[model samples]
Target: MKKLLVLALVVLIAMVSFAKEQILHIYTALDENEWPIYVKAFEQATGIKVQVVRMSSGELLARVEAESKNPQASVWFGGPAIDQIAAKKKGLLAPYRSEAVEKVPAAFKDPDGYWIGIYFGAIAFGSNKEQLKQLGVEAPTSWYDLLKPQFKGRISLAYPYTSGTSYTVLAALVAIMGEDKAFDYWKQLHKQIHHYNTSGSACVTQAGLGEITVGIAFAHDIITKGIDKGYPIVLTFPKEPTGYEIGAMSMIKGAPEPDLAAKFIDWMLSAEAQSLMVKWNRIPINPEAPVAPGAVKMQDVNIVPMDFEYFGAEKDRLIERWKEEIEYGM
Candidate 1:
């Protein structure tokens, strides 16, 4: 009896060790607060243990680039599609076409199946209502309004290369207005901006605190924090056409567990996963997925005509121009 008990204990310990070893390493740009729902759901559905590593988009991108020789994470999820596009071009991500891709909009997914769109976010303005009201200033409705002298030192925005949010905003402006007009517009708007942020989401909260009268950020982020906390914030779209981001996912090339990573991509693009994103206040790219309340529909918005292929190709050049013209305060 004693020998039998010892053998059973040994087997149980081995099983536990094996389960731990099988955990999937997931690298994401999502912060801890925004990550819980997706991570929890993934674990519950697959019973696959997950080890999550979170970092800024730039940090993760650089890390992935450095570790290209020996990829660590099995999947790279939740970044701007452009980052994934760039990585794919560099041969950093393996080609993957999830079955769920069929449900997503064709424009949103990669043509070569290198990445998939999970959700979308429109570039919008976040304003501190109290500050605006106190200043007796009406909220800016048009892109030109951002250049008004009254708003001088009252706006904050992210830098393009460091954040996808900023890049989307820049891309949208260029797409909506001709290149000359966009560059000129940014030069004017720069006069009003009080600070440049690293994270796109930061501008939303900063605006809430009245640290800046306005912030350029994704509409979802502004609404999620603004309305809930009653931070006296308001979300507004530009009178002119605007730009948006395809919150995207991709499997890293040379992943340690290709099969498991593929499974994750499939599950993420699934109707079930897309629906979960709506619960967290993200706009589901899947037409079949239900939209969240107060969420802006793509059909209703005047999305600046996008050419993602062009955007991807020109990203480096455009970002360099922005750094020199916008970030360095030239």
Candidate 2:
């Protein structure tokens, strides 16, 4: 009788815990002003409340790892897919094949359904017009132009360790300049820094406000957040092939709201949600979605062929090297 009573109490506690988690929880790496737009749409469509914890991809990965034993969130939304790939190898994600993702290109998702790409973007330089004018320099037309003697201590880039956007740039440079040369290039570029940022988009905001002469950022962000917003900022791409990020989403391994999480994923991949991203200038991966009016067409830019498998596998080793050699000095 005592065992039966104890079991009843245990079952009641489980029921309460499950009820508490009916409101879906998510870990997201989407920009601050960006995620709310999607969340609003999701709640309206599904009547499911979402709880979000926002962090850059690197920090999100660390948090997910820490919580692996007692998983907290139901989903992870919006970050460089490479980080998602890293998470998949560690058994941190649940595989769910959604019909909404069926039309997404193979290049943007794992064949086995671990992660799905939402959008993709290229790297570019966001130049502060007033700052550049004062310094007598036109917007840089090439990556090397930022290295000119006049630009020293005037360029901003986020910390690669903390910012997936910055890591995408680092990997792109590696693809463009070879491993050793890429490190050397960054070492040179490092001396031109005006302190690194923790959040990737913060540097672009700094440039838009003329706090710095230039900030290395994604082209879509430069367009929507800096240039189109009427800030005194203009974006320019590298003459050589540069890196791009395939922003991805995934379901958590032990999601409390498994069915709801799966629904959220399908909802996000729906044409409705994908189309909504265009207002922010993100080119959605759903082929059915329209590209933003001023979105940079990949064909027009010399894009590096990203090896997701290699880059995802090598991210930790590369980040460690970057910290030792470029960020903190070897």
Candidate 3:
């Protein structure tokens, strides 16, 4: 009788532990206002609960590295793919290839399945019309136009060290202009910058609020968070060609609930999952997924092909170089 009671207790404890682990934990850099929409839909479909820890691009990388010995999350939900590439280089991500991964194109995913893209958006200039008018300037139609004398100390963007979007802008410049020229251009344009926001989207919101005349940010942010919200912001793109970001997801190395994490990843790539992004103004990477109305697609803007592999590997080196070269608020 004693032996039987002990066996029953062990089984009950195992079941309780299993129940406790049913929740999928994720470290996400997705926009705060948008993650709930994706998470709620995912939970409703999979019937699995989700717990999220939201952080910025650089913060996410640091968190994943700090917890390498004991990972806190099972998956990385969203951010630029460059971040995922950096994590993979550090061996912080687990390889995961599934039939659902076939939906994403090669250019947008890691060949080894370390990461996969869910959506994409381009870098754009967001200007509050009233703010621009107050400064006696029209919205800039090209990247170089931002250096205009009237726009001095009126521009804002996140610091590249902490925000993926700002890094994309940096990488994009290097792609369009050669490395030497790009550095030279930033030397002059840095003077036009009023503040360096830490959050990727905050600069756009700042522009919409008229705190700055222009915010260099992702196109979706300008529309969904700026214009559509009635902020008097108008969106424009660089005529000289800019770069876009692939919003990526990956399974963390040694995830506590890998099965649940895999399920979430598969669903995230599905047509159903991609469909949810349109409302948030992200263009789905899946060809089968519906496009957001007026969303900035790759062909819609003058853009250069960013070499994700090269950029991801060089992020650290380039950021250090940026600090050394560009004076703060020059």
Candidate 4:
């Protein structure tokens, strides 16, 4: 009878361990402030516990690549779709056609089901009005204005090596100007940059605090977090067409919890789930979801033509060149 009891105890322990493994682990590239709300909502809607580690898209990509042989997370949530496309090419993403994919526009998703866009926003400059006024300079109306001697050492931007926002800026410049001219522009702009922050939004935060005169970040993030928060900041787009990002979600290859990951993806894309984007001032990809009141409609903006596939494929080479030519020289 004692031997029988011991075997039963072992079986119970195994069952408990299996149950604990049901928790979903995610590496996210979204703002850290937004993760808790998402986690709480997801856990309440579905019984699955979510564990998230928030980082920049570049950092998430690096971590995912490092852990490819022994995966740690089941999914990557909320990063540029171009980064997702790069991941897909690297064999880091697994193809899963979520039911929610049908609701998403074709341009916002991978043709092969590798990743799906959940939201999108345009890139723009955030200037601290008070700081600009103090310097007796008007707010910049175009990218070239940032290179003026008066703006030198007054701008903040993230390093392209570890920031998706920075990468977007680089790619946009390349699309607006030819590749060679874009590189030349970056070399000149480097002199005006006060610092290269590790996180993309950090620059915006700095500008909001008046630590710097200007910052480069997504217009929506700047408007919501900086301007709406009572900071003396103003959002402006470059006179030339601006670039935008389609924030995406993807399943990691060999995810430990494939079913749970798929569920999370579908839940995020659902109208009810996508509605949460408004809280963060993000534009939802779901057609049925209401957009933020002050958000600029893409149709009204002059958007630069971006070849995501080409950019994704050339990401490494471009980043290396940026480091060698821009960062190194600076």
lDDT per prediction? 0.81, 0.89, 0.89, 0.89
**lDDT, candidate 4, at 111:** 93
Q: For candidate 4, what is the lDDT? A: 0.89
lDDT of 4 by residue, 150-192 (tens): 8999999888778888898999899999899999999999989
The weakest ten consecutive residues by lDDT in model 4 span: 294-303
Per-residue CA lDDT of candidate 3, range 199-300, in tens?
A: 889987898888899999999988999988999999998888888999999999999989999999999888988888888789998888898889888889
Candidate 3 Cα errors over 4 Å, as ranges: 2-10, 13-17, 327-330
Candidate 2 residue spans exceeding 4 A from truth: 1-21
Candidate 1 accuracy as lDDT: 0.81
- Stretch of 10 with least lDDT, candidate 1: 54-63
Q: Please, what are the lDDT tens digits per residue for candidate 2 over residues 199-316?
A: 8888888888877889998888888889888999988888888899999999999988888899999999988999999888998888888888879867768899999878888988
Tell me the spans in candidate 4 whose CA falls farther than 4 Å from its real position: 1-17
Clashing residue pairs, candidate 3?
none
What's model 2's overall lDDT? 0.89
What is the descending TM-score order? Answer: 4, 3, 2, 1
Candidate with more favorable, higher TM-score: 1 or 4: 4
Model 3, CA-based lDDT = 0.89
Residue 268 accuracy (lDDT) in model 3: 88
